[model samples]
Target chain A: MNAAVTATRGATALDIAAIRRDFPILHQSVNGKPLVYLDNAASSQRPKSVIEAVSRYYEHDHANVHRGVHTLSQRATDAYEGARETIRRFINARDTKEIVFTRGTTEAVNLVAQSFARPGFQPGDEILISALEHHANIVPWQLLREQVGAVLKVIPISEQGEVDFVEFEKLIGPRTRLLALAHVSNALGTIVPVEKFIKVAKQHGVPVLLDGAQAIPHTPVDVQALGCDFYCFSSHKMLGPTGMGVLYGRKELLEAMPPWQGGGDMILSVSFEKTTFNQLPWKFEAGTPHIAGAIGLAAAIDYLETIGMERIAAYEHELLEYATDRLSRVPGLRIVGTAANKAAVVSFTLEGIHPHDIGTILDTEGVAIRTGHHCAMPVMEFFNIPATARASMSFYNTREEIDRLAAALEHTRKVLG
Target chain B: MDLKDLYRDVIVDHNRHPRNFGKLEPADVHADGHNPLCGDRLTMYANLEGEHIKDVKFEGSGCAISVASASLLTEAVKGKSKSEVKELFDDVHALLTQHDAAVDPARLGKLAALSGVREFPARVKCASLCWHTLNAALDRAAEPVSTE
Candidate 1:
């Protein structure tokens, strides 16, 4: 994009240009063109503060956390646990003990599946999930189903991509042990109204697990206010490093559930005869955790805090509207997801052109978009489409980049039409 | 580097009007190819006359590069012996992956159009899926070939 186009800013609260400067990766060029990164839903780009925080940790305070009497170990332990507190405060969780850092959202869901559902669920019990769930949320339950005769039931969605709440009411029955749902659809950007579902699940004596991987970056999540038993989200999706995420479980439920994995960190005392597990949070985090990732995630939270989540949400919604309007004008373009309430994601398809080809061509023009089933095959099956080209925006993304994307898409249609 | 390199006139034309498309009922050899990443799936069917391919058809959906490559494969492999088809497959594989591979138009003919897929690394699987499905048919494999 030219300087003039890049300079054009939306009427918003946050200074878009300053926000873009914080993320160094956004300044580079790709394929000899200015990078228009629309792949935020996959993994958001980290700001300089986050990058520096991780580097600073390794430089000055590098040691195995929570163990030794060495100064560096104490420092590392303080920082690691402090980061956990940061995440707890970010999500408004009542206690840091509720926040168990996992490898990512997938592992968090797996922990709930193995430790919570696998042991507790009876034969012929149903684990209900929505059609909009990513493979992370859906597969863990399938594994539990295979292990414990737990029947997996899906709450179908409409063609418009919203979760079918009426069908969900029917699906929640006496044997329904849990209702796992995606707070925001990664592929379609449908902001599911999970509060209603959570209320219904509570009435039926069922617990709800909210997959916040796609929602954390775009919206404000309060586990207590949302009334969900478990809330899972990945750090990388919110401008942090990968290999780190948080599983916010209710303290009582977590106390009852057995540890998913046992390793050095998760054990209180181990002998040949018996081994006692560590306390809350540590009991679930086996082996060494991603200490640096946690620190970087804390820095990311600080950055988001300075900017404010509600303000970012408002700006991103504006960007989504601008993108939808622009992309709609492109010949043969069809926006796939159009829920009344959505995040800054536009999953679209150009007529007579496959999404793979669209992605390839867009790459040549320096536009990065996710093009596939997006690990949500069931959602694709519902839409009756092979795949969609998803342009997912962030707070730093501007209208100018979306214009470049639209233009590149026009070129794509010409080439592949 | 350029769009023309990937979507050449011949490739685009083939994508617009794929040859030997749709189901071939009572096919002596059949196999399905699924690229799970992009959801590009195609079932290749062949009626074999001894070691020779008497007829071949495909049915499914995929990207332009994949559909065009499959279309070109059907045209190039028709009435060819198993050994001959194997040779052509080796050449097309090279053309789609190895950028510096030598192409002899005398042997490759129109399949040379797929050489552009070499520039796009991610699309390489898209171009080669049909060939793998075809090989599965030739080998009489029971499982569908998946490009994970």
Candidate 2:
């Protein structure tokens, strides 16, 4: 925890121009013009350091981890376990035993839903979630409800795309077993008050699980300070490779829960009659895990540590403010999700023009923005709009790029309106 | 590709004031189409007299290309037989999808305004959603057509 705090507070000022050179994909042009990438919410572009780290792992220390006595096997095992330690320090977790590697955030949530929640749920029990969750957080619990007879309840949000805290407090009952919510709304960019919510749930003796897929990229997450029973986030959203994610659980709860999948690495010894499971973290990781992905993710964490999360957050907050002020000036364009506290995302719709048309016209000007439901169909349904065009920023983005986005939006209005 | 190619004057005019843009009472056939990708939806209704389409109308919400295509389709097939409408559907589909397919302007008439969709591959689904719904209505298919 001391190392993590030192890393967070150690970085100097971020030179935007110098940082842009580190990402190879940012230097290219898309439709005969320089590309203005505002789709960081979907997946952020990786730095060259992360790419080189994966390549170096495959070239030198390529082996299945934790099995052989050979030299390469030992090296690979060290690299993989070393990544676990790095991640433990990154989020300030007390132990590496609590970290379980999964495919991504979706799989991590599914693991908890099956392994932890399903076994203890009763017929009339309830799982409380907010309306702002991505389908990843909603559907797994719904599947669990189908298996067991538990019910799924939702806490509603306000017109500004904020969760109703008063209603959320009222929804907590003795029957509520778990509280699953997103730390940040993917569609609306509304950062939920997670600490307050966790405190409230703790009083009722209900464990909390936070979907930090959108939060981990922009903010520094301290699991100890948060006191969440479980926290899940993806690697690709934070400048690492895809197909890798982390699920941090309380040590006691993970040990007591049954393994979701049974295979070679998860078992201590297998026979025709019965088998014993392995220790913590390995019991949940069933196979030869994503070795290169873990190493690359560790490298990504190192790169971010050098830049510092606090500085990155401050830089992006300014970018979001600049973009919000600029985009609000566009005629007939209404910005959705105007929560007082938001991350770097801006979702909006133009009158008399569909989002698809807006996306197409923006592409011609070499501006890339996401257009659709953003996989939050309930958010779209709540607003009574089919879809929205979104521009999400990252630390590497500049105010000049926001100006280009605004200019392209103006051109879209003229073409489609 | 130029934005003007996709958003032609004809498409803009028809999208603003769509022809036959309401439900038909005592309709002979009706079917709904939905594009889950962009949440564009439309319902096609036709009043047929014998084998010919006597009247055609649509009621729904969509982008300019979808609404304009449906409006143009209704006008083109107002007096045509069922087989002729099917052939028109195939022709417009080819024009939207195939890059090298030749289009005869004299035959397509106002429907030729959608020829610009060939330049934009992603919008092809948006342009052809209404035509697929029209085919379902003509065939009396029960399931709703989806352009996923």
Candidate 3:
């Protein structure tokens, strides 16, 4: 990763107009102006391939998987299992048995807590997380602490929004059961050095869970290479459907942990007296799974592979640099996160105007950006502000969109100030 | 009316320089109201005289609609009887939810500016926060209510 070549390394004179054509949603107008969407951190827009895959699953092969012997059922099972394999390979997991289908990252975290953390954790046992974690990552631990008498420890972050590695090292001790942290912050887009953190956690014999909700979409994630105990991400944020996510837990750890949910598919045999749970992955995923969601995710993964993740990451980094430099120059605008490495998320505050006001004015100009705390109130508290206006980008976003956003911010400042 | 109409000159004015924006120190009743969906919060304070609201005030952070509505609500119920205020609150709720219910702007006074809030579906809670908190505070007037 050459910093100079990646950051603000200008587009390769490659016509982005052709690439933008792939996303159907981008070719529309909002509020009588051409839409310039910059809110990819929340959920990314899907390409035609992903959408068609979902439709094809429903139209041709739709059935409950795992036990069916009929042709449609076999097809469904094959397609579903094939998706699991795709995910396993995409994240570079050691085995397909390690990948579990979840509703999303929230469920994945809850599953780990309920299954592994609950029974063993004691009052003095501390779980280290970062101040930059989303509510999903924070609340589950708080709930687990209440239930199991475990203590929640927060890893303080620097003003630049990067987690303090030195401080995090000090926080880990004998009683630390798990270390859960975000790979890339949803609000600030600060990319955490996971491999280094994982190595440290491994030395302490504390399992690490990487919340790859932000990282997986931007770049290739190799769970085996990173040596993380668990990794989780949502499909919707990666051009797939909502209500479906992936949790990649090491096979040994998952096998040792009890089942989180119990239903039709999760069990091997059930009786009035005793019930035996099914094998790996299935035990974690109970009841009817998100069949369409899995199909959509596979499509999203295929589409991403076709475009090449390296190219996408490179293009997005350039876009982030361009957006950051331009937005920074705007009068009264202050960019919040200045980490050396980040995804294409830019959170900023304008001098006199509120973030909500800026977002409203931008909406009128057909530029969509997120406002408010971006779901990390502590991060806002760290900055000593109530909220910020965030303009997040994706591979599909163009330089022209960022210019429109910058122009809109200028107009908003003029009007508000 | 266009949804943007909610952001009229008067609405923006009230949002910028809200009246009765501080705590009613020695407030007889205090209560908090929150819109969990969007994370908007409002803390209300009232100084009641027998069955009347002698003075009312509020403080919190939220969208422009929320702050403006709080200001308008405090102004409307300040010197009014408790029962009169309750009836007024009901009238405001009806005006916001029922599109066909014709409400005279003059009758609502400063709150008339917020009538356009109905056009923006997402902003209805912002307009109702003060009213809801006032109700909560009044419910616990005899007993001390902790707004926090």
Candidate 4:
């Protein structure tokens, strides 16, 4: 078979119209107009395959995994573990043993903070993170700091929303124990130069954890290549089901850390006095787990792989450029987060208009965008704004939708001005 | 529901140029109000002479509905007895929230504009944030009130 031809707009090999058809939610109307969903950064619309896979799991293979000797239980166990292998390949991790499943990215981060980092933390030890982190990354470290008397140090961001690399290098001192940072910022869409930071942390003998919830969907992630000791991401943000996420840790690191929670499946044998913990991945997962969610996530990974990640990234870059150009022309509109390297998210504010009003007006025009602090309150504090209206794109989103967003924003100005 | 119903002309006008939109010095009581969902924040201040409201003002940043509602609330509550302000607050609350509650527009006057917020269920908190703060200030409560 011949290689797929790349589209004229960058290296995207996707047929936008064909891809839009795969998502069933895209065909509906909201408030008498065709839905223009630019809220993919919040949660992406799942394809039919993912939805079907989830339903298929519940319909045919609904059974407790690794508990019974029945055919259904074995099938469930096979599918669930098969998903772990798929995730391992997707991120190019060394082994499936490093992969752990949790409720989502929040739980994954909390688990690492509580289990791995907390034990080794000492009073006055510094935990370094960026200013652009979501509350999920910040709060967990703050809680850990409060418990262990550790100090949380933030690497300040630049005026353009990018993390200050020079300041970051200066903040890494002898007392710095761990470095946790967002691979991609949810609020500003700024892709952090994590590889360079990871190299610096490695020089200091500090392990790094990357919050990949916002990165994995937009770009290709290779944990082995990134050299991050821990990486966590959410499935819901990547067109998979909610309540399922992946936590990838280096093999040696995970082996050294004690189990986070103790319960049914995370144990090898349970005696009254001494309970032996299960090995590797199973040791991290303690409960019945979201078995169907794992299957659906595997289907999502298959879908994303079918359409290459590089193509999707390129297509979304084009969309972001188109949106930025169109929105820039609107009078009195200020685009926030104009980082040199960024993702497909555009956050902005119109003069004399609150983001809440903008959101309300946009919804009337069938344009769905997120208008809030985006769970990144510190980012808002840095900008000195209450909130911003963010329109984030996916590969399936069209240029016409960007135009609609601009028009709707113009309408908002007219109504509110 | 129509967007116009929620964002009436009067509401828009009030948002553009809010009345009593500043700090009142030597104020007897003041309370801050925050709507965490949308990040709408305002502080309500009142100078009371015994049981009578001598003056009231608010200062903060928020959405159009919230600022407009606060402006209208300050205008309606100034120079009234504490009991009268309390009664007006109840009436305005009923007007903005109760779907089928009978309300006379002429009696409500400028405050009637906020009745449109009832259509947009999510914005009810935006319209009520200032009123809740005002109530807190009247009761001389020290803690900030939050419309979570």
TM-score of chain B of each: 0.93, 0.92, 0.90, 0.91
Write out fnat for all predictions, comma-separated: 0.97, 0.87, 0.03, 0.71
In candidate 3, the residue pairs with backbone N, CA or C atoms under 3 Å apart (3 or more residues apart, or in different chains) clash, namely none
Question: Which scores better on TM-score, 2 or 4?
Answer: 4
By DockQ, the best candidate is: 1
Interface DockQ of candidate 4 = 0.73
Q: In model 1, what are the clashing residue pairs, if there are any?
A: none
TM-score of chain B of 1: 0.93
Q: Write the per-residue lDDT of candidate 3 for residues A1-417, one digit (tens) a residue.
A: 011122234443333565566789987888887888899999999988888999898899998888788888889999999999999989998889999999999899988888889977888899999989998889999999999899999999999999999999999999999999999999899999888888899999999998999999998888989899989999999999999999999999999999877889999999999999999889988898998899899999998887778878888888999899999899999999889999999999888676876877788788999988888888887898778889999987877778889999998765554
The CAPRI category of model 2 is: medium
Residue-wise C-alpha lDDT for candidate 4, range A278-366, written one tens digit per residue: 99999999988999989999999999999989888888888888888999999999999999889999999899999999998999999
Look at candidate 3 and tell me the lDDT of residue B58: 92
Deviation from truth (RMSD, Å), model 1 = 3.1
Each prediction's DockQ?
0.82, 0.76, 0.28, 0.73
Candidate ranking (DockQ, best to worst): 1, 2, 4, 3
How close is each model in CA RMSD to the real structure?
3.1, 4.7, 3.8, 3.7
Off by over 4 Å in 1: A1-12, B141-148
Deviating ranges (above 4 Å) for candidate 3: A1-15, B1-4, B36-39, B142-148
